[model samples]
Target: MNSDEELSPFNSFQFWRVPLPELDLSLLETEPSAGSYIAPSTKDLEAMET
Candidate 1:
């Protein structure tokens, strides 16, 4: 009858029923946001070649 009993890892009957935190899905949004992406400069690219 207890919620904890249903969610406990010790309970083999509900081992897969443990609650999870809400996922951060902002990155999956269709629209891009400010600071979400950045283009590397020519100098930065050249340094990677070395």
Candidate 2:
């Protein structure tokens, strides 16, 4: 096979580009909340050791 045929197996190829709209952050919540942390189980700790 030639160099161009080896590079591309298809006879036709097309390239497309679509423009996206701008984003609005005014509707989103900006406040941060604290999350609760839980300790790992004894079974989980034993699996990590192996």
* lDDT leader: 1
The whole-model lDDT of each prediction reads 0.78, 0.64
Among all windows of 10 consecutive residues in model 2, the one with the lowest summed lDDT is: 9-18
Tens digit per residue, CA lDDT, model 1, 1-50: 66996667776666556688899987588877876776899999999999
Residue pairs in steric clash, candidate 1? Answer: none
Candidate 1 stretches greater than 4 Å from native? 1-35
**Candidate 2 local distance difference test against the native:** 0.64
Local error of candidate 2 at 16, Å?
A: 82
TM-scores for all candidates? 0.30, 0.31
Count residue pairs with overlapping backbones in model 2: 0
lDDT of 2 by residue, 1-50 (tens): 57886756454443233556888876474654356355789999999999
Angstrom error of the Cα, residue 36, model 1: value is 0.8
What's the lDDT for residue 12 in model 2? 45
